[model samples]
Target: MSVQAPRWRAMRVSDLPAASAVAARVHPGYPEDDAVMAERLRLCPEGCLALAGPGDLPFGYAVGHPWRSGSVPDLDTLVGALPVPAGAWCIHDVALLPEARGHGAAGEVVGLMLGEAARRGLPEAVLVAVGDAAGFWQRHGFRPVPIAAPAGYGAGATVMVRSLAP
Candidate 1:
């Protein structure tokens, strides 16, 4: 028997609740604000994505917006809009439910997101990898940057970046 792969799509405004649930579950002890989630989708709908399986509810989500390279946004806080001169694609969060793990869905989403970044003429892709997820991002070619992470993202949180060049 084989497992069916989950599908990925642009995140809709209505998908926030499911995305929030997955975020709260996978990122234990990390904060997630409903309004912030909505604001992210509003700020850059192209960078917001959802992953789902045989069921209608989303099993995972990815949130991001175009941003500068040197600063990491605080967790659970809302940034009303992305900066006009946004140079890097800052991935805010990417979390999946346990049941959805091992399907390699994350890599698919990251690839799509990177393409979106390139399409928008962004040269760098940045993310704050919480916990040990840095290696996962590393597998996808992200390298750690020596920038400080925001408070409450917990220890081992790293700011990583990857080039979007082909």
Candidate 2:
């Protein structure tokens, strides 16, 4: 018998609790409120995804949305609305439990997010890489941008961007 590996899928509202748990586990140092995550999922469902384990519980999740370039939303704050003339895809957060790492699920979802951004006519994707995660984002074709990240993101936070243009 063979065991099926976990995979990324479109995030459903039902998965928010698991997603929040994943975030709490993976990013305890950079906490976000439950409402902040809910708002992101509500505002841009297409930008949210979950890596489901057996029984479909989320072991990891990604939350993103459209926003202006080179900007970092304040941590734990709810974004009232996405910008009307959104210029870039904002990768709000991606978290994975230790057990969920070491597979290609993260890369898969990053590609999905970037593809969706291109399809939406956005020119670039941006994110604040927290907790020394800049290298991971770099591997996925993101490059560090020389802009100061917000204080709430803590030290070593980097602003990264990847062009969605061909």
Candidate 3:
């Protein structure tokens, strides 16, 4: 039997359960309500994606939305709405199961998110790098900015930014 590798695709409402499972498994220290993710998808479907394996089951998910820069949303809380005339792309979260790691899926989704942001004419991308994820974000052209990350992001969370300008 041939095994199929996971691939990135548009996230669907049905995938929320799996996405939440992946989040719980990958980031126990940082928990987010499934409704928060659902709101993001509803608010900006273009910025929501899932890494699907066989049977189209999601093993990882990425959620982003339009928002102001230099600000980090409180973890697990719903934004209620995305900002109009949004100034930047806020990469809310990206979670991958251990089995889904080392396949470049995360990086690929990041690139895709950045592309979406650029398509929307956003000038930059921002995210809170939790735990040891700062290095990973740094490798993706996101530099740790001087902004104060929320304490709800857990210890060692760093606010990172990457300019999407050419």
Q: Write the per-residue lDDT of candidate 1 for residues 54-138, one digit (tens) a residue.
A: 7567999988789986666888887767888988898888888988889888888898889889999988999888878888999
Residue pair clashes in candidate 1: none
Q: Would you list the C-alpha lDDT of every candidate in the order shown?
A: 0.85, 0.89, 0.91
- TM-score, every prediction: 0.93, 0.96, 0.97
**What is the C-alpha lDDT profile of model 3 across 1-166, one tens digit per residue?**
9889999999999999999989998998888888999999999999999999988899899999999877868898888888888889999999988888999999999999999999999999999998888899999999998888888897788999999989
Error of 2 at 13 (Å): 1.4
Best-to-worst order by lDDT is: 3, 2, 1
Worst 10 residues of 1 by lDDT: 1-10
Identify the superior model by TM-score, candidate 1 or candidate 3: 3
Clashing pairs in 2: none
lDDT of 2: 0.89
User: Model 2: per-residue lDDT, tens digit, 1-166?
Assistant: 7767989898999999889888888988988888898898899999999998888889899988999987868788887999989999999888889998889888888988998899899999999998778899999999998999888898888999998888
What TM-score does candidate 3 get on C-alpha atoms? 0.97
Candidate 3 residue spans exceeding 4 A from truth: none
Q: What is the lDDT of residue 106 in candidate 3?
A: 92
